[model samples]
Target: MVNCKNCGTNITSKFCPDCGQPAALKRIDAHYITHEIEHVLHFERGIFYTIKELITAPGQNVKNYISDNRSRLVKPIIFIIVTSLLYSLVAHFFHTEEKYIKSVDARTIENQFVITSKIFQWLQNHYGYANIIMGLFIAFWAKLFFRKYNYNFFEILILLCFIMGMSMLMYGFFAIIEGMTHTNLLMYATALNFLY
Candidate 1:
């Protein structure tokens, strides 16, 4: 028997009994890289599966994830980050500019609220993190309103993450349509997102 590299446990089989680390670790190579990618994007139990579940039956899927089976769904935090990043990339690719902010004198804005402007710019650039911050605020309000429910604040945040992630996907899909058609559909997208 070999010692487990991860936890120094004696291994008698393919994995470590104590730590579950593989008996033999694969060297980093092209095959390893390909396998890792497949592991993450695999259709059966990866992001695609999670997206399908979220889209088809959001309420029941989330309920199952929170209560019964966590493995079937992608982790809530990762789901939000991946979806938000996807939306950001698609928006950038489509050259979609922020609609509200138009032709403000940088000097005056910076001089008035340097920190606030910086924070806003950062949030605009990094949507994944920005969405998480937004989710925290949303989760707080949801928790307050649904105090009768048994779920805690963190659980509510998980629900928000799944929901916000799906919303980001919706936005990304709309961004694609807008880019292809070369027509401004921001209002329609926003309305549909709210309805969703």
Candidate 2:
């Protein structure tokens, strides 16, 4: 057996048993850089499959994850982070909240609308934190409603994280559409998302 280049330990496999590093670290050359970038951008597994499973069979996905098939699905915390980042990026690039505010009739605002706008702005600015807090509430509510499911708090939290992460993307786009069209599309989206 040869010593692992990474940790100088006897390793018979391609990876170091102790640290999980490759036994033979590749040189930092053009080929290695190209391969690494390609693997991250093209071959890496995430997002698409996560969203697909969340959409197609959320309950099954949750069950599978809790029942020892965890490796097949993305981790709930990572999914939440990724989806939150996506939501922030889309909201910033498109200015959906600003558009929505502008689309509102001035007459409708009258006198008290300034405070309402301020509240909306605060909510938008702290959306990531708000989402996490909301997920906690959602998990509690689901646990209460689905008592027969017999899931504990943390387990239900994981399920809600995956469920909310998937639906958040839809809410982002629906807001964009509502802003662009100056329509009441958000009302319908809100109803749909509530049931989601």
Candidate 3:
């Protein structure tokens, strides 16, 4: 006899005595229900609005948001969400060459590193591409200039996230220009950076 999945009582009926849950689970539907659609719409609206505000307003938005008495600006988590979206768009647009030409007498992971660096360089060129570089500067500035802030390094990181998040709006604008021009600024930036 087939045993009841729920309550583990002997199979007499479909449901078990302990609880009224189904003994046999129903198969999942191919299409999601309206409830799922509502949930997705709700989530997407929040993200879209947040990205719009964050990208458009930057510092003013952050100041009026995290400090002032308003609740409409995008949350901090949205920064990561939009960043991931930008990364996804970049990944889709930038396809690496899979074919590797064998060197005369040496085999190294140089090709893979080059490809990875290219992607990072591309991202940096577009999104304030100098974000990490500027971040280091900001980090140093916070250490020395803001010595009276009385905050630790970790606290500075939190502040930097906001500062950089705001600065990244500029990066996004440049990304649009680069995308339209069909030119990768990263190539030039990489050359200059390497030369230094």
Best by lDDT: 1
Question: How badly does each model clash, as a count of residue pairs?
Answer: 0, 0, 2
Scored by TM-score, the top model is 1
Encode model 1's per-residue lDDT on 136-173: one tens digit a residue.
Answer: 99999999999999999999999999999998899888
lDDT per model vs. reference: 0.85, 0.72, 0.50
lDDT of 2 by residue, 1-196 (tens): 8887667889989888987888767789999899765543342245677787777887887888987677666678777766767776776776665643333333576865776666666666665666678889988888889889868878988887887777667767776776567676656766777777
Ranking by TM-score: 1, 2, 3
Q: List the residue pairs that clash in candidate 3.
A: 124-129, 128-171
Which one wins by lDDT: 2 or 3? 2
- Candidate 1 clashing pairs, residues 3+ apart or interchain: none
- Model 3 agreement with the true structure over 78-180: per-residue lDDT tens digits: 4543554464354335421111111222226546566655665465344433444455567677888878866665445444555555434433444455566
User: Which ten contiguous residues of candidate 3 have the minimum total lDDT?
Assistant: 96-105
What local lDDT score does residue 164 receive in model 2, on the 0 to 100 scale?
A: 74
Off by over 4 Å in 2: 1-9, 24-45, 98-122, 140-148
Worst 10 residues of 1 by lDDT: 97-106
> So what's the TM-score on candidate 1?
0.89
